[model samples]
Target: MKNLQKILKYALNYKKYALLNIISNILSVIFELVAMLLFIPFLNLLFNEKTVIVSSLPQFSFSKDYFEAYFNFTMNQYIADNDKLAALYFVCVLVGAMFLLKNLFRYLALFFIAVMRTGIVKDLRKDIYNKILILPLSYYSEEKKGDILSRITTDVQEIEFSILNSLEMLFREPISVILSLAVMIAINPHLTLFSLILLPITGLVIGRLGKSLKRSSSRVQQQMGVLLSTVEETLTGLRIIKAFNAEESSNKHFDQQNSSYASLTLKMTRKRDLASPISEFLGAMAMVGLAYYGGSLVLDGNSDFNGGEFIGYIIIFAKLIAPVKAFSSAYAIVQKGAASADRVDAILSAKNPILEKENPEILNTINENIHYNNVSFSYNKSDIVLNNIDLKIEKGKTIALVGESGGGKSTLADLLPRFYDVSSGAIEIDGINIKNLSLHGLRSLIGVVTQESILFNDSVFNNISFGTNNASREEVIEAAKIANAHEFIIQLENGYDTNIGDRGGKLSGGQRQRLSIARAVLKNPPILILDEATSALDTESEKLVQDALTKLMKNRTSIVIAHRLSTIQNADEIIVLQKGEIAERGTHSQLLSQEGIYKRLSDLQTFSN
Candidate 1:
């Protein structure tokens, strides 16, 4: 329920629509209330039961019963002067007019509610998207991709059609119930009290069901996140699944989750559906009790209500049924929405670890050298991955990192861009610590290209010029030519306009690497970080990628992480890492002269090739 209030705060964004919805719905209730109350006078005119023809209008009073008696006198005056047929016609026209106005306002109310419903959905989704963008990359590492996606898509949709629409019912339905009850009490006070007493029993039954609904709804939402995660992982690894002939196993896993989701959803729906009938049954029992008790009062002449007023009181009580049921239904929906709201707020409320410093230095370039001063890092802090490492690379010099797997080569390179901050110590560019620099400005000076090309499902032109927001087509072509990608790109069906499919699947391995280089070239940053860039390609593709990488690395301070020892042989300095510590550091030739780890590694690779 607290979550519901928090979610409703978003309704302020589209307040005009909500205000109109409230005004129109309130008008509808007023007109509908008048319409229902008109029945007593209308019934009197038709039956001609109250026949004392009054010469003047009845004096109004402050009492709650004044409107009831005043209207009764006015109708009796008309009935006394006119024929029975004419009086009946007059009553029919008034009843029809009241109903017509009532429905018209109801339609207008619905129109404004529809606008608010869609508007709130749109705003919530946009907020989720914006939050996703600002959240640190580590958030995705700890969180499930599909769960985040489910919150953005399915959970938001549930809030829209189920919860947001319930907001309308919450406001409008109570007004209806109040108006109907007020009229009933005026007509027959004793009968209205009899109906009100049984309401507590109805509330207890519905309240129990509502509590269960929230728990079941939360389970259903969690299962949906898992279900979507299965589909997402399956799509990402579809080729591996097919190649390994594990389709049946994957299908079995998915089916199990799907079945659990369906079962949980069934439980929630069943619990929510119980509210209507429980309230309805109890309401009907009270309605039947009022009918018998009110009839006896009219027969014994112990009450002010005659048969016509008694029947009209019952009619107004009957009108209370729809609004009471609607309120019950809306309550159940709000309980379910609270579950989803908690899930959504979990992401929205997360604090980011990689935040920029206040009044931080803005870096335009690396002037002197990039220094790693006693730097160490760990993914989970238990086992340190990069130990108290100290190194420096002068501006415009290429530093190569070589090591066995899990030696933290990639992690070391990642520290430069602050993808993951060091567990201890600090990294600095020139004289300033990286932490003291603005993240965007610090990263703008560096470009990264990984082994697995991270291209989007877009045109080659757009992919190449991705971050260079104002890059021209000529610049894209020039960058491509420098990376040796222009020849292949121009041969494509649409050339620069050609779509790259998912993750550049439309291009060959070498072509894809070249496009990555082209993107890095266009960004034209002063510092470049290459993480096993040519490791994934065959010898032929490696040669082309290596050549393009050489062009991209020209005059740029570059950090190279290479698995193949032969590719980085020309680096200005080579650092060899063993386990989580740096074992050796020097130029390739200088390290070879040492005949230590570098020599052994170079010998092994040379012998294998």
Candidate 2:
């Protein structure tokens, strides 16, 4: 219910629509009630040809008797002035007009609600996407991508179907039931009280069924996430699966999850489907009891309940059954929706580890050297990835990090932009702690090109100008030329406007890397971090990418993480890392002459080449 309330909070954002819906629904219910009340006078006309007419106008009051008296007086006057048929015609026209107004207001209510319903869903999706963007990278290391995808797509759809779709029933039905029940109490208090007794009993039964439904629905939603995760994994690893000829095994695994999900959905839907019929049966029984009691009163002559009024009361009470049953079904549906709300709330309420200071100072440019003061980091408590380390990198210096795989080179470079905060010490730029600076201001000064060139399915121009705002066509082309991507880009059919397929699959590895470099060049940050930018390319692509990287790194404070030793031979300084600690630090020539760890690594790579 807490999660359900959180979802309803989004409705507060569009109060005009909600208010309009409420007003329209209230009017619709009023007209419907008046339409039903007109049937009483029609019943009198049918049963009594010489019906007794009230001679004078009745005093106005709020009780049912006064309105009934006034209505009778008006009908009597009309019948006397004309004939009974003319009076009946007037009543029929009035009833039709009331029903017409009822439906009009109902349509208006639906019109207003449609805007609110779709608006709430749009805002919810926007918030989830924004939250995904701001969450620290470490959050994804433990969570599955498909499960998060399920929350944004499938879980939100469940909320729309089960909760938002019920908005009409939730708002309209209750008002109908309340207004009808009030009239019932006015028609006969004793009978209305008897009807009320049956409701709580029906509610108790429905409540029990609903409790298990939420639990079952939650399991179904979770299984959906697992099934989606399996599908996502299979799509991502299709090439590997085909290479290894593991299609049979993969299919069997997917089949098992699919079967489990189907079973859970079947059971949950069965429970949810039970609510409507049970409410209907219970309401029918309550109706039978009310008729028997009310009929006894008219027959025994011990009460003033007449045949015509009794029949009208029965008609209104019967109308009440439909909405009551609808209410019970809506309750069951809301229970199911609550399960999905719980899943969405988990993400919406997730705590972000990265915190910015309220009045953080701006970091527009680097004036002096960057410093890593006694830095230590660990993904967890026991497995430290980096030990206490201190280093300073002067502005405009190309400092290269060389090491074997899993030696914390990438982790060290990642810490500079605060992808993950240090576990112990702090990193500072221009003598100011990075934590003391605004994230946007701090990151705006740095550009990163990683081993995997992250490119989207977009035009060559848009991809290059992704993070850069208001970049013109000439600026984008100039940036591509600097990264050596302009030659191939112009050869394509649409030049800069050509669409690069998913992850830039339409382009070669070298082409993708060059585009990544072009994007960095366009941003033209004062600081650059190149993480193995050419490690995955062939010799020809490597030479092209390395040349562009050299141009992009010119006069910028660059931290280069590399595995190919030859590429960093001309670095101003090279830091060799081993076992999460700095093993050696010197110029490439100086380290090779030391006959130490750097000397052995350089010789090993030299031999391999």
Candidate 3:
């Protein structure tokens, strides 16, 4: 219920439409009640075979008897002046007008509700997406990609179907039921009281089943996420599965997850489907009991309870059943929707650790140097990745970081961009703590080309100009020339405008790497971080990418992480990291003279070559 309340809070954003909808529903209920109650006068006219006419109007008051007396006096005057057939014409016209206005208001209510429902859904999707963009990268490490995708796609859709579809019933049905029940009680309080006794029993049965359905629905949604995760993994690892000849194993794994999801859905559907029929059955039992009791009063020669009014009371009570049943069904669906709401709220309410200060300085340029002052970091408190490391790289100097995998080379570079903040110490830029600067302004001064060469399925021009907005074609081509990607790009079907397929799959490895370099070149920041940029390339591609890296590094403060020691021999200084500590720091000759870890690593690579 709290989850549903949280989901509905978004509706407040469009209060105008919600207010209009409520007003329209109230008017519609009133007109519908008036239309149904008019049948009582028609019954009285046919059965009594007599007419009582009032000569003058009574003084008006706000009692039910006063309104009834005034209405009866008006009807009596018209029937006395004309024949019963004329009065019949008047009644028919009045009933038709009532129904017409009732339906008009009902449509208007639906019109306003439509705007509110879709607008809330749109706002929900936008909020979820915006939250996803700002959540720190560490959040993705613990959550499966497919589960997150399911929350945004299928979980949201379930909310729209199960909860939003019930929005109208939640609003309108209570008014309909209350108004009809009020009229029933006015006709005979004894019968209405007897009917009320049976309703709570029906509600109890439905409420119990609704709770069970919610639990099952939660399981079904979780299984759906697992099923989607299996599918995503299969798609991403299709090549590996085929190469290993493990298609049979993959199919069996997917089948098990699919079967579990189907079984849970079946149970949830059975529970949800039982709500309507059982409620209808219980309502019928109550209605039968009321008929027996009410009929006894009329047949016992009770003058106060006439046959016409008794039949009218029964008619209004019958109308009340429809809305009661609708509300019960909606209750069941809302329980199911609450499960989905919980899933979406998990993301919307997730805490983001990467917070910017209220009044942070903007970093415009790097004048001095970047200093890592006793910096230490850990993904977890017990497992440190970088330990009390202190280093500095002056402006216009190149410093290289060489370490074994998992020794925190990439983690060290990532901290500078605030992908994850340092666990313990501070990184300062030009003697100012990086945390004291705006995130955008700080990251804007640094350019990175990573090993993955992350590219989108867009035109080469758009991909290259992705973050660097308003880049002219001439500037893009110039950057491409610097990265040595212009020759191959022009040979493509549409040159710079050519659409690279998913993740640049249509291009060769060298082309993708070079395009990523071209993007960095376009940004042309004063500081650059190259994380094993040439580690995965073949000899020819490495040579091409390495040459581009050399040109891009000229006169810029550069931090290079490399596995190949030959590439960084020309670096001004090389820092060798071992077990998250600086083991050696010097030029190529100076490090070799130490004959320590850097010397051993360089000798081993030389032997391997």
Candidate 4:
């Protein structure tokens, strides 16, 4: 029910459409009642059950007595003057007109609902997309891309199918049942009362099936998430799979999930499909019982109804069955819809942001320095990744961190941008605690380039000017030249306009890294963080990128996670990290003279090559 309220919040945005749909549906129900009751007059004409009137035609009035008396008198007058055939034609034509009006209003009602449902789908998807963008990076690390995508795709679609489409029926079907019940009660109150008694019993049976359907629905949706995750992993690792010849293993895993999903879907279908027929059967039996009771009264002259009137009562009673059956079916759909609503709510309600305080100081520029004061960090809280770390980086100087692969080098750099907050202590910029600074403003002063050289499937120009969308062509070309990327970019098929395939696949590793450097150059931040920028390239490629890196690092406050010892020999300072703590701190020569952890790592890389 809480999830349902959340879903309703999205619906309420277009409340005018919802209200109009209800109004239209109410009109449709009224017209349908008019059409159905026409049968009563038609039955009287066919059976020739005449009621002689000594009084003249009653004046037209809003009262029920006037309406019933006046309409009967008019029908009888036509029968006496013309013939039964003319009167029957008039009633038929009247019924057809009422049906035409009913359907017209129903069409208008459906039109409004279609607009609302489609709008809600578009806006809801947009909201989820915006939320995913603003979510902290750690959220992505902890959650699967496939499952998040499934919530936006499959689960949202389920809500559209079972909830949005059912909105009209939610109003239409119930009002139809109510109006039909009213007419039946007007004709024979006792029989209507008897029929109403059977409904709660039928509801209990349908309600049990609805609960079972919801359980199956939730399982099916969960299995779909797992299946999506499998396919996503397979696609992302297709290259590795082919290299290792693990197609059979992948297929076996996929088959297992697919079979499980199919079984759950089969169960949900059976449970949902069972509700309608069961309700319909129960309704038919109640109608049969009503026939026995109502028939006895008519035959014994215990009721005012003649044979035709009794048959008319049965016909109206039968009409009520359709809406009753629809109500049961709707209950099943709502159950399925609720399960989907829960999935969507999970994403919207997620608390992932490294929240900033109100009235946080705007940190638009870098001046004095950055400070890490006795900082310790953990991802899961059970294992610390960086422990008791303290470092200072002044403006207009370079500091290089060197260590093993998992020595918390990258994690320390990440703190500067607040990608993950420190579990203890704090990082200060100049004098103010970084947590007191606006997140957007603080990140704006920093630039980063990583070993992977993340790029997009886009044009070369767009890739270079991604964050700086307003960058002029001259600015981009200059940035490229500084990073040594301009020469190769000009040699491409379309120069700056060349389309780089996924993750810059169309370019060499050196070319991709150069573009990454060019992107950082364009941002032109006061502070730059390079995480092993040339570690993945060949010797020749490394030389090309390293030269570009030297040009990029000149006269800037830079933090370099040096993978190759030779590249950072001239750093202003060197800090060596070992297992989660700083083990050594000095110049390159100073570290070598210490004969410590830094010296051993430097020797291993130099000779192992």
Candidate 5:
């Protein structure tokens, strides 16, 4: 119920529809009760032989004048005119009309319930997607993609059907039960009180059983997330699985996760199923008790208790059972929905670790210099990835970062784009700290190409124009030519329109890398960061890409992270890093003369060549 309160806050905005549904449910219950009670008068009219008027009853008696007045009016208007034939026809017609009206209002109530149900579902999914888009990249590094996807789809669907729909039933069914009970008590208080005594016992059983269901449901949802994440990872790396011939190993891993999920689901289902039969059994026992007591009172010839009223009491009691069943079932659904709400809340309540300061300045363009002054950083309080790094690049100069792996080469490149902030220092473009600049403005001024080419499942033209929405076809083709991608792109089945499958899988590795470079070229930023852009290509592809890279780097303030020693030989200056510190800094020829780490790296590459 607490979880229901939280979800209702979002649903509260559509109160008009909820109110209308409530009114319709009330009307439906009223009409249904009227239909059930109509049988009392009609039965008395048919069984006139033993029909006991109020004045004729021995112990239970009314004043003769009042009883005669009511009796004469009923006989003259209804029973005496048509006898049993007329009474039976009248009861059938009246009951049928009441039922028709009840069903009509019931349909209208459910229609509005559907509106509120789907509206809330739509709003929740939209909010979750928007939050995901605004969340920091660092957030993704610590969470699984499949878990997030499951929250948006499976978890949200659970809330819609189980929670919202259960609320609709909860509101309508309880009202129906109450209305039916009122009619039952009016006819015979003794039977109504006897049946209601079983209610507290049923409540105690339900309370105890449902106490653990919410906790178990939460565990089930979490296990499902794990299974979904495992399947996602397996699909993403299926090629590797086949290449390594690890099919049996992958199947065993999947089976383990699948079996765990199955066990949790079975447990949750057992807990949910417990509510139904327990409620029904209690209701049936109450009915049996009523039948024995009411039959004995009628057989004793007590004029106070007549056969027709007894029959009406039984019909009303039967109506009460359905709503009681619904109440118990809806309670179970509420528990399941509560579990899902907690998962969604976890994602929505998470605070972004990286955010812009208030009233941040916007930097439109860079003119003077890009400076890294005593910059240091660490991720998650671990060993420093960068330490007191100091460097400067004039507006139009090429500075190459040459270092071994894990030497913070790519980390430095990432900072220039503000993908991360320095832990203890500042990075500035044109003397203004980048942290002070608008995030959008800071990213718009730089372009990046990494070792792994990041492209989507789209046409070649869209891939190149991804960063520049208004780029013309001619501009796109020119950027492709500069990236040495035009020749292969035009030869495809659909030329620029050809679909590059997921992650550009339909293209070769070199082709994908060139397309990434083309995307950067189309963006045409003042500062470009090439992080080992040619390291993954073969000799011939590297030569072609290096030529394209030379064309792209011309007149741009470029930061190149080079792995191949020969690639940075003509760089303006090369900095060699060792364990988050600069070990050597010089031109290629001067570094060779120093006979240090850079020299050894160059010699090794030379021998390999």
Candidate 6:
């Protein structure tokens, strides 16, 4: 119940509908109780029992005169005629009518409750998805994609089905039990008192069982996350697993996780499953005892105990069992839902370490220099990836970064687009700190092409025009041509409309890179960051990509990170980084002549003189 309270805002949005459901449920319970109570009159006719007649209805300020009049009138008419069969038939018909009306309103109440429940679930899912999209890149580094995916799909669904559904039952079933009990007490107070004794014992047992279910459910949900993440990883890297011939190894890992998940699930299910049978057994015991005690009193001819009234009391008592069973089952579901809610709340309440400042400045375009002033960064607390890095690039010049792996080449490239912020110092554009700029405005100023060419399972044109919405056919083709991808795109059976299968697996590595370059070209931002964009290409593909990159780099402030020395030899300035700091900086010829880190790297690449 407390777990549900966390998301009350979403639920409260449709409070009017929820109120209607409650009203309908109350009406349903009233009608249902009326249907059960109708049995007393019918039993009296069948058994020829003494009429427990009251001359006037018990006086209460709120009691309506019409209700008392109707009751007296019916009783008098039955007594005067003494037609037992006709009275039984009339009571049976009235009972049937009340039952029918009860079922109708019950259906309507459940339908409206479902609407409110599913609507909140839908809104919650949409909010989570939007948060995923807007969250900083750093958030993903420590989180698993499959875990997040499970939260959105699996955990949320559990909350809807188990949590909210339980909440509905919690409301409706208790009202039913209370209404039925009221009628039972009205018929026979002594019998009602006998039945009430078991409630405390039942509550204690249920409480003891529920105490462990929430913790067990939480463990089960976590194991499920691990299992799902493992499966996701296996599927995404299936080709690698096959290529390495490690299917047996992968299966062992998957089986271990699967077994753990199964064990936890079995434990949770056992706890959840225990509630119904245990509750039923307790209810049965209470009913058997009540029947014994009441039967003894009736056999002794106690003035308050009558055969027909006792039968009606038993009938209403039987009705109480169903609601009790429902509540016990709902309690288990609520525990499971609480466990799920905790997991979801952990995510929803996570503090994003990186957030845009208030009253952020907006940059429509980058028309001046981009500066990295003593920028230092670290992914973890242990070691710095970049340190004391000072560099500047004019608006329309090309700057290239060259370094060995772990020398912060890619990290430096990432900082230009603010994919990550500098740890120690600031990055600024046009003398304004990048942190002060709105995230959308800062990112809109730059385009990136990374080593891995990420594309969705979509058409070529759609992939290229992804960033720039509503791009025309002519504009797409022009960008493709500039990327050296137009020729191959046309050669495909569907040309620009060709579907690039998952991650562009249908295309060759070079072709995928070309498409990625085309996507960046389509956006045509003022600044470009190409991180080893052509490193994985063959000589022939490299020539084409290098030509495409030359065209794209023109009149744009481009920052290129390269492993292959020949690719960036013609840059305006080249910087060699070593151990998180600038080791050397100069033009290509000057660095080559100095025979330092840059010259050593160039020589190691076996570049032509």
Model 5 lDDT-worst window of ten: 52-61
lDDT of 1 by residue, 1-609 (tens): 676777888888878988887788878877776766666666664566755445566677866556656765666676678866776687668878887887898898889888878887888888889989888777898989999989988788778767887988987987788777777766667788888886667767777787788888889988999999999999999999999999999999999999999999888888887888888998898788878888888889766678778877887777787788778877877788888888888877788788788999998988899999999998887989999999999999999999889998998998989888899989989879999999989999999999999999999999999999999999999999999999999899999999989989999989999999999999999999999999999999999899999999999999999999888989999999988799999988899999999899999988988
62-143 per-residue lDDT for model 2 (tens digits): 9998988888899889988999789888988998999999999999999998998999999999999999999999999988
TM-score of 3: 0.96
lDDT accuracy of residue 217 in candidate 4: 86
**In model 6, where do residues sit more than 4 Å from their true spots?**
1-4, 52-69, 78-82, 296-305, 607-609
Stretches of candidate 4 off by over 4 Å are 52-63
User: What C-alpha lDDT do the candidate models reach, one value each?
Assistant: 0.86, 0.91, 0.90, 0.87, 0.84, 0.84
On lDDT, the candidate that comes out on top is 2
lDDT of 2: 0.91
Question: If both were scored by lDDT, which would come out higher, candidate 1 or candidate 3?
Answer: 3
Tens-place lDDT per residue, model 6, 489-553, is: 99998999999899998999889988998989999999999999998888999899989999999
User: Which residue runs of candidate 5 sit more than 4 Å off their true CA positions?
Assistant: 1-5, 46-76, 181-196, 290-307
Error of 1 at 305 (Å): 2.1
Q: Please report how far candidate 4 places residue 494 from its true position, in Å.
A: 2.9
Arrange candidates by lDDT, descending: 2, 3, 4, 1, 6, 5
Can you write out model 3's per-residue Cα lDDT over 1-609, one digit (the tens) per residue?
Answer: 887899999889988988899899989988988887777777877888344456678789866567667777878888889977898889889989999999999999999999989988899999999999999999999998889999999989999989988998899999898888888877888888888998888878888888898899999989888888888888878889999999999999888889899999999999999999999998898889888999999889755777778888888888888898889989998999999999999999999999999999998989999999999999999999999999999999999999788888988999998999999889999999999999999999999999989999999999999899899999999999999999999999999999999889999989999999999999999999999999899999999999999999998999999989888999999999888989889999999999998989988998998
Clashing pairs in 2: none
> Per-residue error at 427 for model 6, in Å?
0.9
Specify the poorest-scoring 10-residue window by lDDT in model 6. 60-69
Tens digits of per-residue lDDT for model 4 on 1-609?
Answer: 689678867778888988888889889888887777767766765677665462578877765467667767877788788887888788889989998999999999999888888988888789889889878889999788888888999999998998877777877788888888887777878888988998777788998888788788889888899999899999889999999999999999999999999999998999888888899899988888989988998889756777776888888778778877887778778888889889888888889658898999997777898889999998887988999998988988899999988999999999889998999999998878999999888888898999998999999999999898699999999999999999999999999999999889899999999999999999988889999998889999999899998988887889999889998999999999988999999999999999999899989988998
TM-scores of the candidates in the order shown: 0.95, 0.98, 0.96, 0.96, 0.89, 0.94
Per model, state how many residue pairs clash: 0, 0, 0, 0, 0, 0
RMSD (CA, Å), each prediction: 2.0, 1.4, 1.7, 1.9, 4.4, 2.5
Tell me how far the alpha carbon of residue 580 in candidate 1 is from the true structure, in angstroms, after superposition: 2.5
Worst 10 residues of 2 by lDDT: 44-53
